[model samples]
Target: MTRRSIGIVLNGVTGRMGYRQHLVRSLLAIREAGGLPTRDGTLWPEPVLVGRSEAKLAEIAARHGLTEWSTDLGAALARPDVSIYFDSQVTSGREKAIRQAIEAGKHIYTEKPLAETAVAATELAELAAAAGLKTGVVQDKLFLPGLRKLKRLIDGGFFGRILSVRGEFGYWVFEGDWQPAQRPSWNYRAADGGGIVMDMLPHWNYLLEELFGGVRSVQCTMATHIDTRVDEQGESYAATADDAAYAVFELAGGAVAQINSSWCVRVYRDELVEFQVDGTEGSAVAGLRHCRVQHRSMTPKPVWNPDLPNSVPFRTQWAEVPDNDEFDNGFKAQWEAFLRHVAEDGPYHWDFASGARGVRLAELALQSAREGRRLEVPRLEVPR
Candidate 1:
């Protein structure tokens, strides 16, 4: 059996998502598991941490017991051993770094909304295509156990001729005055390329297209419920970005998807985000970890009797979807898939173009909200 090592230059890993998910949970976990198994041999992932703060990068490297850490991106890219570049940086800084990585002739994997704007994202896609580089954008939700089960039902024709999809996603983020904000302070600043719309609409766009039909049009409204919030330093600043977004999307198959994404709403559901998809033959509600379904044959009949006390067990009517296979963390799953794609030239499609489409959705959603009207979601063409 042959053995090989794959060096990955990981940037922006000092952030929470980058450190927890990409580092500890995914790449490090893969490394600790005796590398990723392949037909010929094993592919070991070696992470070369890169960030603005050398101190923070050194600390992380020390914690992981790994040594190749650098503060200069150009120096990291110069290493011939590093064949891949992974970025989990802020939205505003992603495009330039990705462009540089592409120029350096490295395969790339990154967080979503590939760039702050659609134009820059398209350019990156074009550049990568021209350079013959393998690229992937994070679409972690698609790999969730619940979504996988939902996908199984869709494939099995359980939801024959799907009709509509309704999703509710949110939890109240404490203002820094009372409690330190769970999210980064930059997330609420528009100047820093922040907002729930930019952060979430990309997720919704991919989820809609990959599972159901592609989005044909969109209508949306956004709001900033909290005008001011304290930062990590206990200094208050204006929350200029929208904290909530209510959107209605029309799919190509004539199905409608209504999604409400917010950071200010209280949670009453079983999960942080839940999607309910209804069709002619059945309906299913899926969260991050669980899925519940109701067949058309077993659906209950509830008449309009507002005067009398309701006795029907609406929630009990649906059956829980069993997990036939043990589920790994969604981020880890995607990381393995991407690794396989890079190692063996496996099939991968969540590319820069797909991410650009997501950015386009957010841009149009904002425009739709401003105009107070529905807008068409046009086909995106990346001119290479």
Candidate 2:
């Protein structure tokens, strides 16, 4: 069998998500598994770590037993061997590098919120399409086991005319006074393209569209509950970005979706992120890895008593959905699909155009919050 090496220039490897999820979990894991096997050959991923810091890139390369590491992004993009250019960089820093990579005739793949604005994101998509390059964006949540099960249920007529969806996401990020903040300090700064809406609305946009329907309009309110927070350097700075976002979306098929994303709220649910879907026949609540359901036949009818303590155990009424098949890591699953797309020219639905739509949702939601009115989400047109 022929063995082919597909070189990938991976930028933003120094950041947390870039290092842990994209590099270590996905790419390195693929490399460790002897790469992806095709009909004619094995497509081995040869990754060149690209970042701004020479020392960090070198350290990561050495730690992973990798040979190629570079601090010069332009030089890395110019390499003929590197056919795929992957970016998981900061939101504000993505557009320029992605434009450069597209100009260099490389297929593009990157994390979402493709750019800080919808205009920039659409421009990148147009550039890639004009260059005739295969491009993909990260929609990893669609591959989660719980979401997979939810999709199965929907397909099986379990919901029976789905009605609405509710999503609760986020955890309290430490203020960095006593404990260091879990998220990067840049996440709370508006100047750095940071906000809960920008960070999460992309996920919700694609998710709602994939599950229910396209978002038609949105009404939202955002808040910066914690106005000041300590940074990585132990210096306090004003938090200009919204720490919390409450959004209500009207879907195309008359389905309503309400999503609350916040970094200041404490967790009281089964997972860090959970989505509840209600329908005419049944309801299901899905966490990151688990799903629970309550059918109409099994649902309880409890009398409301204002004078007496409630005796109904509403949480215990739901039954857990059994795992019928083995599940892979969501990020890893997408990575494998992207690799196959690169190797065999396979069909990938989550392209730059899809990402541009997500950016449109985020932009609309932010505008709605600022204007105090419902804003319509117009469809993005990119050359296919």
Candidate 3:
């Protein structure tokens, strides 16, 4: 067994996602699983943790029994062993770091919202392409168990002809004055590239495009429900970014999707986020871990009446999709996929250009909100 070791410079390990998902769950898990399988042998990822805080980085490294980590990104990138650069940093810092990675000739993988805007994201894609580097963006939702099952049904013609989709995603992020905020304070600051639109529309774009069709237009409205929140330092600050966004998207072939995302709404649903897709032959509601379906034949018919008491076992009508297969962590799956792509030239469709498109969708949705009208989405291209 020829096991090859390649270093991945993981920037932003001090952050929430980079630490938990990318570093621990994905890379370390792969190491525990005997590395990523390859035709030749296995490709092992050696992580070079990079972050601003030396103390925090050191702690993470020590906790995981890892030794190679540094506060300096340049030095990390300069290492000959490092071939892949992964970013999960603040939105503002993403473009510059990615550009530097590209210049360093590293294969790149990064968290979504590839850049603040479509232009920057497209530019990064172009730069990566010019350097002939393999690149991937984290499209984690498509790897989720529920979404995977949903995709399966769609592919198997269970839905017949997909018609429309409705999505609800949010939870009441506690105002830090009463309780410590679950999310960081920067999430509510626009200048720092924080907002529901920038954070979530990218997710919606990829999900819709991959499952149903490409989004063709959008109508959106956004709001800042809580203007003030206490920061981690116990200082109060105004929330300049929109915490809530309601948007309706027009997808290719005239499919419609309406999605609401917020950090200020109370949760009264089955999951933190849920998507309901209705088609000609059937309908399905999918959450993070579960999917339930109601075919046309099994769908209940309710008679509308203002004066009569309605007693329909609506919730019990849909059948729960069984766990036909064991699901791996989504982050780990994507990481393994990216590593395989880099090492063996395997197929990976989610490139930097796709990330750029996700950013473009967010941009247009924000514009649509500002204009108070629906706007057409133009096809974005990254120059070869």
Computed on alpha carbons, the lDDT of every model, listed in order, comes to 0.94, 0.92, 0.94
Model 3 lDDT tens row, 4-100: 9989999999998999999999999999999998999989989999999899989999999999999889899999999999999999999999999
In angstroms, how far off is 344's CA in candidate 1? 1.1
Cα lDDT of model 1 by residue, 1-384, tens digit: 667899999999999999999999999998888889986699999999999998999999998899999989999998999999999999899999999999899999999879988888888999998999989999999999999999999999999999999999999998899889999989999999999999999999999999998999999999999989999999999999999999999998899999999999999999999999999999999999999999999999999999999999899999999999989989999989998899998778888888889999999999999999999999998743
lDDT of candidate 1 at residue 244, scale 0 to 100: 99
Under the 3 Å rule for N, CA and C atoms, how many clashes does model 2 have? Answer: 0
User: lDDT tens string, model 2, 177-217?
Assistant: 89999999999999999999999999999999988899999
| Model 1 TM | 0.99
Please identify model 2 stretches exceeding 4 Å from their true place. Answer: none
Instruction: TM-score for candidate 2, please give it.
Output: 0.98
List of clashing residue pairs for candidate 1: none
C-alpha positional error of residue 343 in candidate 3 after TM-score superposition, expressed in Å: 0.6
Kindly give the stretch of ten consecutive residues in candidate 1 with the minimal lDDT sum. Answer: 375-384
